[model samples]
Target chain A: MLDLSTIREGDSLPTVVKPPISRSTLALFAGGSGDHNPIHIDIDYAKQAGFDDVFAHGMLSMAYLGQLLTNWAPQQALRSYSVRFRAITHIGDEISCSGRVSEVFQENDEPRVRIELTAANQNGDVKLIGEAVIAVY
Target chain B: MIDRSNIGKSFPPYAVEVENHQLRLFAKAIGETNEVYTDEKAAAAQGYSALPAPPTFGFSLSLSKPNVFEAYEALGIDLSRLLHGEQKFDYIAPIHVGDVITLHEKITDIFEKPEKRLEFIVIQTSLVNQHNEHVGEMTNTLVIKN
Candidate 1:
């Protein structure tokens, strides 16, 4: 898990790789999570929905950020993390997941670390914007 | 066609707990091979209290709840026709192990087109703690087809 004593504000850890979004990723997200929205997996169905192509699941993108946090804190101990779906992530889009230590504080007698999180595509269009709170033990 | 009245109607309250093993299972299935999700030490080095739930972790928080769907079927809308129009959340705090979250649901909005056989219900859920601290809110538009 996460040890707060070792972290510092603006302390950037080893940069992680931002993977490319693939149709296969969407298929897996649909099958594994049971999301299965045609707009997210079938190109023809997506076109009918007014999309240019199949889009990645919004949760799949959010999952990337969660993966990033787990690297910082461990066994799904996150108190809470939230986001707004801003744009459609088309297949083959390159999404870069990045975060910066936005704040460190104390709440309810517990140490807390707040970070502003986001996933942006190669075109610099942001797909999601959100925050995560980690309670230090 | 789905009933217009059910558009803004919220079913009931439900809750789901985040378990460590389940978190690991999701991470592995999603191809999140990092130690932070799979190993405790990697998470510690990165500065975590434990294995962090993946960001979309909010889904697991409110996924399967007992009896709430009874209200959906009561409307006579086919469950399979429901499509998630969107999913969004706001993280107000961190959820640790043993944290049992209660989800309060409300139908925020509903729309029906005269020529369309479907109705859209804007479903909103607030995941709160026992003390009522807001944990997160999940909003999605469900398409109800006849």
Candidate 2:
């Protein structure tokens, strides 16, 4: 649990590194998310779509960022979260989800934290950029 | 060009039950070792009624709607050329396992940037629990390359 009393602007969140994605990971995600797009599961179809190989679903990476946020704070604290997919995540890419407190202020007499989030691969290529707002005590 | 006439149109609302096993699978897929996400006993110890749906779990629930592709087909979009551009979630309350949440989705907007060779179709979705309370709203932007 996050200690709202001690959190400060510019404080960095603990980084969460994901295991290297494999074909089975995407298939499991597809089963869970119900996103059975062939480009994500079929290498032949992905190549037909002019890609080198199958790619990870963008929402999967976003979910990793969500994991990062919820780990730091309670689920009830999350007010808003948004992410823009920046680049494709290939099947073997390892994503690292990280964030930092950008600002803290009062909204309607309640404390709120605005955080900037990023999911990047081992090669230092960013896959998604996002921002999240949460209500804190 | 996307069929702009579909803007403001809403799809049929559907209900999804948040299941613990699916939540555990998702947590595992994300490499989340947090017991509260996968263990009911741990979650109860943490003061939650049940294993809470991991953040973004709503996306999975929302997409599970059977009529999902019908929304894109309405706009004359070819599934092959579709790409996810962005996604946003507004969490108003905690959604837990066994909650029967209903998902309502609509085609909110459509725009194009000819110079960039892209067209965007934005869909806004809302989730309400059986209690008639708002759980969250999701904005999903899909891009079509020219």
Candidate 3:
């Protein structure tokens, strides 16, 4: 849980950097997420679809952002989350998830915080941008 | 082109049981080190009745239908050209292992940008547990290249 007394509007959350997305990770995520889109796992299919190789799933990047949130506060504290896919995450790209407190306020007599999130690759190309609302003590 | 007439069409509700093993696998796949997602004892220590499903784990449950692409297929969407454009989740209650979640999904909107050669389909899903309590809702947007 976040310390409401210390958390400021612009406080940065700890960054979560993931290892380079590998073919094996992609394959495992397919079975785990139940998102077996061929574009994310089959290189031959990707080539047929006009790409050089298979890429990572947009949900996978969102999952990483989810981790970034849960790392700061428990999963149960999350009230809402949303994301927009900005760019494709190609294979072997190392994704770094970062976020900051965008606002702090009270709702329904409970304290809450809104966070702005971003997932980017080693090349500085942002793959996803997101926002999340969490209840605070 | 997607049939705009299909908007507001709701699919048959489907139910999925949250299993501990599935939670463990998903946590591992996402590189999550939180023991509360895998170890029952650790989860209890944290006040969870059982292993708590990780954030975004609901997406996997939503895809558990026998034909994952049934809605898209019925909408005349070419699966090969589809891409996930956006996703939003509103968490109403904490989902845990052993909960049976029934998902009610529907096509909320369908539109296109001819000049941009893009077509968009928006799907909204409401999740309710066996006890009839609303657990969460998901809104997913799929973009198709023309």
Predicted model with the maximum DockQ: 3
List residue ranges in candidate 2 displaced over 4 A: none
Give the higher-DockQ candidate: 1 or 2: 2
Better-scoring candidate (TM-score), 1 or 2: 2
Top model number, TM-score: 3
Better of 1 and 3 by lDDT: 3
lDDT score at residue B20, model 3, on the 0-100 scale: 81
Q: What are the runs in model 3 whose C-alpha is more than 4 Å off?
A: none
What candidate 1 gets wrong by more than 4 Å, as runs, is A1-6, A75-77, B1-8, B12-25, B35-55, B58-104, B108-122, B126-146
Give the per-residue lDDT of model 3 (tens digit) for A55-127.
9999999999999998889888899999999989998999999999999999878899999999999988999
A1-137 in candidate 2: lDDT tens per residue?
Answer: 56679999999999989989999999998887778888999989988888889999999999889889877887778889999999999988999999999999888788899999999999999999999998887
DockQ for each model:
0.20, 0.77, 0.84
TM of chain B, each: 0.80, 0.93, 0.96
Q: How far out, in Å, is residue B133 in model 3?
A: 0.8
Q: Given candidate 3, what's the lDDT at residue B129? A: 94
lDDT string, candidate 1, B67-144, tens digits: 545666776755445544456655566555456778887778878755867577777888786667886677766665
By lDDT, the best candidate is: 3
Q: Which residue pairs clash within candidate 3?
A: none
